[model samples]
Target: MIISNIAAPLLGLVDTAIIGHLPQSIYLSGVALGAMITSFTYLLCMFLRMTTTAEIAHAFGARRSDLAQQTTTHAVVIAAVLGLAIILLRPVILQLAWAVIEPDPELQRYASQYIDIRLWAAPAALINLVVLGILLGRQQAKYAMGLVIFTNAVNVVADIILIIGLDLNVVGAAWASVLAETSTAALGLWLIRDLLPPWRQWHITPAYFKQFGAMNRDVFIRSLLLQFCMAVMTGYAARFGAVTVAANAVLMQFLMLISLGLDGIAYAIEALLGAARGQGSRHKIRLWMRLCALWSLLFACAYSVVFWGFGDGIIRLLTDLPEVIQTAKLYLPWLIIMPLLGHWSYYFDGVYIGLGLTRAMRNTMAISVLGVFVPTWLISQQWLAEEHANHGLWLALSLFLLARGVTQWFYLKRHQRRLST
Candidate 1:
């Protein structure tokens, strides 16, 4: 799981590295914003992954082979449909995304180049999400790792050839990603052939379908809230001008690398926690939570040190633009603080989801977004309205992290109490 999750972000790292050396910094920055918008869109549909994992894991644990099969089928079908819908809504999504950033005409043109080309990969990307979820559910960690490695490897190679060699610019970078993801989706589906039953025998039972639908709904809502926060974060970053936005984009890539790396641990927690819950071992749940928290904090501290120590060099590697480097250096401290406060919520999210506590997760996220995240963002915007808009953006984001950790802790305690009773 660790390798699988890590590989995906390494792909992005490679992309960033290549683009960082591009002749124009604007192209790099445009790719960053464009990537964020695309990522935000894909993340909004992430329930295809999360809900499928929980449903398939539970079904398999309960010894219901038919239900397990149906879960995978339903996930693929729904993901396909949703992906098509996103493609159809591409113009609308692009319009809204542009409204948020409102970049200059040239950068906007580049962003559109990236977004429009990448939109074609929507169905493949979403299906890949479902395939990953199904693999994790079946405890096929190695398979998942292989798929991610293969996908990212192709992406890196393609990115090099297209962006550097062919000089297709942003469009090359975007198309590289699309091709890699599409290949991954195809390969992942093929790899799961043995696990799936024959097509003729497949049918969704009403009871299993209802359960699957509810899980999907919960995860969909939870993911929406999560993605909304990310969209706002990206949008806010863009308001600070191209240099600021680019710096934030570089910093965010690093943050995501940390977050997703830690997620490998969380993914382990989710798998083990789900297994423990299946066995009705309440004590195991507590144990998993404690271990996850302990490990997360340790890793967070380690990440903080690495980023603090080598951040300047890292930023330099990403871009040669003096302003982008200078701005990213200014923001380095917050990058250090982020993992310390942010890692907990991610771990808790996995634990709760593994326990099938989606309602609590959803409700807490709702409160965090409305009560904590949005208000802090607005306040920060007002406070830094004249100069230093990025300051407000970072502060508001920090508050959002604090809110997530606090709220999730509250609900997790309540969950423990219920389990005890």
Candidate 2:
């Protein structure tokens, strides 16, 4: 899981490197802009993956092969529909995305070309999410790992061949991703052939949609909240000027690294806990919780130590700008300790997803985002000097994460009696 998570991000780095080799900087900027849109739209739809994983895991735990099969079918259908919707709405999406971004005409042209090409694989990319969810839910870690590697491998090769060999430039980079996603989706379907429902047996009723929508509503909100907070952080950081914003970007990468490593563990927990909860096995659920906590804590501690020891060095490696590096160091402490405070939310997230208690997650996130994080930052802007305004922003974010974990903890405790029974 960790390797797959880590490998996923490396694809972006590779893409950037490939595009960076171009003589003109516009190619890189264009691809970057298009990729940002890809990230945002896909992010909003991530709930499909989590909800599907939960459904499959629960069904598996309960020994309901029929339910598991149905879950996969349902997810594939929804992913297809959503992906198609994205394709059809591509024009509107581009206009909306560009409105906020507002890049130059030349860069916009390059990015639009990339986006137009990339949208061709929207259906495949979205379906791949459910395919992965199915694989992970079955605890087929090796298969999941292999699929990720396969996709990345295809992408890397295509990027080299089309971008370098054919000199397709930005278009080649876009096509690489499209090819990778489309081919991987096909491979994923083949890999999960056993789980696919037969034509005569397939059924997707309104009840399924209703239940699925209910299950995913909170998850969707959670994704949106996370995205909003990220945008808010970036927007707020921009207030301090280019150097501070750049530093925040660098620091944000650190947070992403932390989340990626921890999320690998969370995924495992989701599967384990979901299966256990499905079976109503209190003992198994308790055991998984205790075991996951120990390991996740160990991993979180390692992140803190690495950041504490080499945070500045990592910053320097990311950029040669001394000002950005220096500014980033000023807030490095928050990044260093963030793992300790932030791991709980990630941990509890797995728990909630496994138990299929997204409403709890939704409520806690609302409180964390609106009740705690926003208020803290708003107060800080007025209370703290301009020089230290970013400090308050950091403080709000840290507290926001901590608040999520804490609130979820309370949720678990509040319902412990019912759950254990």
Best by lDDT: 2
Candidate 1 TM-score over all chains jointly? 0.95
TM-score for each prediction? 0.95, 0.86
lDDT per residue for candidate 1 within 305-367, as digits (tens), equals 888898888888878878788888888888888888788888887887788888888888889
Error of 2 at 327 (Å): 5.1
Could you list the CA RMSD of all candidates, in the order they appear? Answer: 1.7, 3.3
Span of ten consecutive residues with least summed lDDT in model 1: 6-15
Candidate 2, residue 357: how far the Cα is off, in Å: 0.6
Clashing pairs in 1: none
Stretches of candidate 2 above 4 Å error?
6-8, 16-34, 98-117, 159-173, 199-201, 235-247, 316-331, 378-393, 418-421
The C-alpha lDDT values of all candidates are: 0.80, 0.81
- Give the CA lDDT, 0 to 100, for residue 11 in model 1: 55
